[model samples]
Target chain A: MVELVVFVLMGGGALAGGVTVIKARNPVYSAMGLLGTLFAIAVLYVMQLAHFVAAVQVIVYAGAVLTLFLFVIMMVGVDKEEDVRETIPHQRRLALALGLIAIGIVVSLVARGRFAWVPVASAAADPQATNGTVQALAEPMFTDWVLAFEATALLLTIAAAGTIALASFRRPVADTAAERTGV
Target chain B: MIPPPEINWFALLPLLVLGLGAAAVLLVDVQMKPHPKWLVRMAAAVLLATAAGALLQGWWLRRLEAGETVGTPLPFSGFLIVDRYAIFGTLLLAAIALLGLGAGQRFIVSLGRRAAEAIALVLLSTSGFMLMLSTPQLVMMFLGLEIGSISLYVVAGFSRQERQSEEAAIKYFLLGSFASAIFIYGVALVYAATGSLQLFEQQELLSRVAFVKPGVLLIGLALLIVGLAFKVTAAPFHGWAPDVYQGAPAGMVGFMAAAAKVGGFAALARIMATAFEGYIETWATVVAGIAVLSMIVGSFLAVVQSDFRRLLAYSGVAHAGFILTGIVAGEAGIGSIWFYLAVYTVQLVGAYAVVAAVSGASSAGSPLASYAGLAKRQPMLAHALTVLLLGMAGIPLTSGFIAKFGVFQDAFRAGFGWLVVVALLASVVSFFIYLRVIVTMYMEEPLEDRVLVLTVPLRLVLWTTLAMTVVFGLFPVPLLRLTAISLPL
Candidate 1:
């Protein structure tokens, strides 16, 4: 019952956010919807026994990065009066076809005698379970995957440097205006 | 589930070396001052040495027969495989970087700045690429992908002063991060259902309980495909390619597009071949859909682009679609993709070199119109550019044509006949765009500002690129044989 409820929440979140991703008038709102959907999905992960991944989903997706989307939205803030394009006429047909195909697949699976939802065994004992915890994640992370981890850090550093470089190079508005004015 | 199989060290040595080399370059750049070209040279030399090591590794692996004794595994547990495929691809990428940089010497020095940091970053990016190609584990794969991606993000905006470059960098970073989140989430779900992250382990489980975890695993696969698709700039995920390519410096743009795509496809190949192989019928349809969309969208889009760099970006998308067809073909497609990427890296890097040389002043950037009267002004460069362009168009006598031919044939052999048909049609559509470039250069009259002058090294690079394009296209038998031998049976 808990799994079903969590699934409904996640499914609902996904449907709502996916629609808003295309339908929202403001890109910022669309980004917010994406964030919400992502969070709900992370909750689903927790219910599915992916606790560590759920935490990572929140940290990496919701916490560290989506802010970039917010920043871009604010930076490119459009006027409220600007006309937003709605979905095209043929889009609904595509959606309908996809929906039908998906339903067909689901119905076929149900017919195949595979809906047995065996409950998961009780969560492993605490000591054993802790080994699968985030703390344990650190060991393999540092030793086996150390090179890749360090590489990520280096890559991000370069991105920072590049960002600074690009910002420094933007044409000053005064110069653009001067050029326009035949200065 | 059984834990991952024993670590294969020999198969992972190249990645270890690349990682170590990247760190060394970063430290060296920090400690040194911007002075003579020696710093760039040193960085390039280190990369070349690494490439040499990778080449030797490939040769040794090639020497292994069907029943030869296995070699010792390289360090870092069992994350990466140091097989010939990884070694060859890594070496090729490194070589392209070296040659592209060497040809770009005047261009960099003319910026009145040091190339050390930029070169170091490029080297580090290549090292990330090495890891990306070789890593067999999902976590390791993600790590490699991010390292390569972040490096390219910085490289895209390396010019710093150009607004377009800034816009491109920001757009790529934002979209890429979003896609990555989706991908990681999918990974989490897959792990939840299967209790494993290694491909073979996932595959083994998938074969046994495919019906049991159908919903979760299928969803995971879809999300994973979306993530990888975004990396390769496939349809619906390719919004950032044109702007980013146009904004970046030509040399770096070439490296980013080729190296990044190769790494992305490598991971894609690994995933489909292992974890998702059991559901070939389902994922094959999805991949086919993507392949068709990418072909149509990328081809038509390229025909309309006014910027040469942007056009190439679109062409890159179309090429990605073609490559994916081979992937959709399943087993036969894997080795084909490896071969095709090798050809692609060469042609793409060569083409971008030409673009960099012609685009003037390292700062003004390459506008499509700048090529007006290119043939009259610089016959040699024009010739080389034409060959590369034709190669990209997949015309006969160019390596690209043969590469496409081989993969499309492979697709048919693997039971994706419809995909091959769509691929051929896409190729025809792409022909117009590629020829548009050729016509603009040859038939179109030169504008007033057009003057072509070639430096010695630049001339040499152009000739070499041109020659290789023809040689590989016409005499592909040897290359094909070599690639086949290298591929895991």
Candidate 2:
């Protein structure tokens, strides 16, 4: 019952936060809404015993990603909201209607008990067997995923060096006649 | 303490050599004040070493097949699979990178102090694609694809002084990221459906348990196809090729184009043949449809392109279609696929080398207008372009013809006869595309009295490509048989 209560609260919080992310007029509010959603999601991950993912969710998403979003919002001077007029005729009405239809489908499906809240039975899918802790993740990451882990170094190198290659403001002798002289 | 997984160092030699080489090039660039020429030579040596590593792997694989104990072929827990296919693909990519380094010597030289960066990125991208070609694990494939693609994104915009180069970089980066997203999502869906990201494990699972609902799996497969199709620039997903080709430094365009196609086709062929073999009825028809569309669209659009780069880009699209013809046959066409990729990519680099010669090394846009009477202006280059263009057009006594013949025969035998017919028609139309360039080079009056001062490196690249095209066209047995052993995925 406590699990059910926590699930309902967190799920509702996530949905509310998602709605606010789009509906909020202020950019800061939108970011706050996004943070709320992220936190709710992280809480859900914790409930699933995917503790490592939940930590990453909190650290990466809530801390780093949301901070970046806020930074951009501040740097860009975030008073720009769309004019509250529909670009398309009845876009808002149609969106509302579609949203209603979506919610109706979900409600009907839930009422009919059609949703499989639990996943299929599998060794890999068992939360108790393969808890998403750092220790649980470490073995495969080093052994089976070792190549992928190593390849990420290459990917990071590309990112670092590629940025410098593209953004570096040094184009010395880009089209000099030395090329013509074959010197 | 858990024991570390066993790693076969022999299987990983090529990738390690390339990774270390890339790091060395960057370090050398910063530490030593070497001339751009020396950097080019260094990069070339690195690519050659990469090829040598692949050859070593090939020799080792041969010994293993002969009942010699050299350790497990699938090392790193099956993350890296070294086989004839991997060896052939690695050799092909490394050779192209080497030739590309030779062909783009002028472009690299133009960069002056930054030449080392370009060389390092090239080596890195080649290593990435080699990984993509060799790995059977889907997540690893994604990682490899990103490594190759992200490097090319930067390379595509190497001449940042040109506005179009920056535009090309942005365009390729955005579209490529989207394609990468689509690919990872596909991988996720496949994993969700099958509980495994390794293609071999997925195949075993799929063969064992017949899923009542295979919708998610099929969608995942189609998504994978679309993502790879974008990389190979097959029609309907080829919107960015012309712009990117025209805008990127002409010297490197061919290399960039070939690198993606080679890796993309290698992975595509393996995925279809190995993992989805049982679902050939479904995917084969889809591939045939894509092949038909690529041919028709690539052929028709190529005729109208006024820019030489754009024209080559469209012809490349058509070639992508031609290569897809080989894929439609599933397992039987692997040899043909490799044969076509090997020859066509060499021609691709050579053609762009000529373009780099005509245009300045760092310039964007080689207007077709500039090529009028190129034969009168520069006979050697005109003749060189003629050979490569004719080779691309699949004329008799050229490697293109043999490549086309091998693929067409495979498709026909695989019951994709109609695809072969469409491809043939497309081939005829594409002939006109190359012929147009040839006529512009030979028959038309010179737009300007510009002389091409052919460097030794450029000359060497041209000669090497021209020699390969003719030699393989006439005596295709060595390459054909070499490719045959790389079969069955």
Off by over 4 Å in 2: A1-44, A76-115, A118-130, A170-183, B209-212
- Candidate 1 lDDT over residue span A1-183, tens digit each: 656776897889978987887788778878888888888888776665567788989999988789878887778774446554656878878889999999999899888967676434223323235433465676666666665555566566556544544444545588788879999
Give the winner by TM-score. Answer: 2
Q: Judge candidate 2 against the unseen true structure and give its global Cα lDDT, from 0 to 1.
A: 0.90
**C-alpha RMSD in Å of predicted model 2 compared with the true structure:** 4.9
> CAPRI verdict on model 2?
medium
Candidate 1 TM-score over all chains jointly: 0.76
- Candidate 1 C-alpha error for residue B62, in Å: 5.3
Alpha-carbon shift of residue B231 in model 2 (angstroms) = 1.2
Which digits, one per residue and each the tens of the lDDT, describe model 2 over residues B371-434? 9999999898999999999999999899999999999999999998889889999999999999
Interface root-mean-square deviation of model 2 in angstroms is: 1.8
Candidate 2 chain A, run of 10 with poorest lDDT: A118-127
Q: Once superposed on the true structure, which residue ranges of model 1 sit more than 4 Å away at CA? A: A1-183, B1-13, B16-36, B59-75, B111-114, B361-365
Candidate 2: the clashing residue pairs are none
Of the candidates shown, which would achieve the greatest lDDT relative to the real structure?
Answer: 2
